[model samples]
Target: MSQQPAPRQGPIRRIAGDWHVIPGWLPVPDLGVLPVNAFLLAGPEPMLVDTGLAALSDAFVAALAARIDPADLRYIWLSHTDADHIGNLDRILDLAPNARVVTNFLGAGKMQLLGKGDPARLHLLQPGEVFEVGGHRLHQVRPPYYDAPETMGFFDPVDRAYFAADAFGALLPAEAASVDEIAAETLRDGLVGWSSVDAPWLAHMDQPTLGRMLSGLERLAPEHLLSGHLPDARGLAPLTSVIRHAYARGTTDAVPPETIRQIETLLTRS
Candidate 1:
């Protein structure tokens, strides 16, 4: 008999040089809010990172248009075929007639299976291929863990920013303009908690292998770490550290009761 709260769009803000974030928040009944974000690279060759939530399609489009003309977009970098990431793919492709959907082979195939995207407009990338756009070279870097197999993260050489797709996402107690606003303890709890639910197989992953992947990202030393479900962050160290420590001995005993409750609530709602 009770109505659920609708997801709301947050103010659009710049993360760095030409990267702007279009943020939205989804309310979790007994838990806190989860941030859902899409990014825009307003440059000579404009590109969009994700399409944001379908529930906020109008607001997302309006927010994007305010920054750059939809038709001016050169590429739509889909992180994966997850609903939140590709919710507005069809709508965006329709609006951006000249734009191409930049994705991997599997990603393109997944789009076909969903009955979304135009084959003629797809720009598929081979593994280890670097995407060049607007004088920027985007090197594909797979995140340590992901809910979708087709997920593809990237690092921008121009801004030293790493877009980690769904990795490093957290469910915070409140909306934050930046990661600096959340307390260290809260961030750790939230990050580990969200990962447990998002990628449940993480607990079964080989410890040494996971550590090596995290180390590799740390060595990349991105100045800015961008995530789909968290506010803008400065570095990957803080996040990588939290994940490394949490899963050092596996996640079975690491997750807190509150996190379990939150996951249960989410399942029941769905």
Candidate 2:
């Protein structure tokens, strides 16, 4: 089956000083809208958090261009090798010939295996190492939950902004510009639901162990929690709170047998 087109346009919203977001809403079957987002670190380094959805390539490029000229982009941070995050990667590389793709070992290998990027333009990152771009130092931190092993998040000490690759994603009943727009219960349910689907291992995690993970983020107290699937969030409490509450007794819910079968069939066809 052909892929569905994502929403064409998403307004660029500023989350904090020099930190801006471009959010795209994509629809999922049986699930509501999922926010597919990319962030911009607008400063001396001028790095892009990730490329937006491929279905909205034109809009994504345009949104990114509006923030800063494609040629001016110095770094393209690949949070992971996931299609949603790396969708417009090549296109952006074409536009920003000077920008290097910053990613870890597995991410670079996946890009080569998938033929999605040029290795010559790749900057391989080491575990626990931080890179200094322009004047800002970006620390590599793994998110608590992710679907891909190559997944990595970035922490900006200057702005206290955390770019959580695929973690904290939630499927919402409707498109929201920010987490504050979502109701308390809806946000909780959506957060747990998406977590269950994206990282089923959560169901097997011990409560205290999970709490420690969630508590770690709480300790950071990021000014903005940037998620690939969630709208702009100002605080980590709202998100971490939901995960803690839902997973306290155990995981949220198990993936349905039918959904697994459907996925297996689709993979076979592909």
Candidate 3:
């Protein structure tokens, strides 16, 4: 069952030049609350990074309208076929008749399988392809970790903002307007904890390979790191450092003893 909380109507906060974000929170079982965010690029040709949660459909659409007229939206950038990310897609499409659904072939196919998205309105992007909307050049970036194979992130050269679909997400003890408000240790634990849940295979990944992937993002030198499940962040070093050390110990196929014990206890009780 979904652990998403009631939609919190929030103001659109500017993260970088012309890049605005609508941030909300979702409860993570036993871990705290995780941010559920969607970005808006206000420019000559406006675009939305991801549609917010279905639970907040009205508020999400209203938030977007507050930033820009729905009729003026030029693109709905689908990060993936994830429900949280695309919950209000059809609603937004109805509002923005001129907007096209920007996604990759796999993403389009998944939407087709789900029988939701309109094929005729899709603007399919090839791997490594850039989507130029007005003054901003959005380069497709696959994050180091993600829950979906078809997940697509983006790097905006104009603003030096990297929209990581689900990477760098964390669970915090409380709702934060910005990542800067989170304590260093809290952020570290949250980042690692959320990664453990969202990307369990991370425990089995080769450290060197993972390090290389993390390094690549470092090279991007993004001024702002935008994560779907993270509050607006201007720094990437802290987040990367946490990931680096957390997985430094290397891969393990065995489940944690604590988890096994809990499962056994539950079975016995039942």
Query: Number of backbone collisions per candidate, in order?
Result: 0, 0, 0
Q: Candidate 2 — which pairs collide?
A: none
Error of 3 at 14 (Å): 1.0
Please state the error at residue 13 of candidate 2 in Å. 1.9
Winner by lDDT between candidate 3 and candidate 1: 1
Residues 117-169, model 2: lDDT tens digits: 89999999999999898678888878999989999897887888888888998
**Candidate 3 local lDDT, 211-268, one digit each (tens):** 9999999899999999998888886888888888887764232235464344223212
Please give each candidate's TM-score: 0.93, 0.92, 0.90
* Global CA lDDT computed for model 2: 0.82
**Residue-by-residue lDDT tens digits, candidate 1, 21-81:** 9998878765588888999988999999988887788988998988888999989999998
Q: Which stretches of model 2 miss by more than 4 angstroms? A: 1-6, 252-270
| Among all candidates shown, the one with the greatest TM-score | 1
lDDT winner: 1
Candidate 1 local lDDT, residue 216: 96
Give lDDT: candidate 1, residue 174.
88
> Least accurate stretch of 10 residues (summed lDDT) in model 1?
261-270
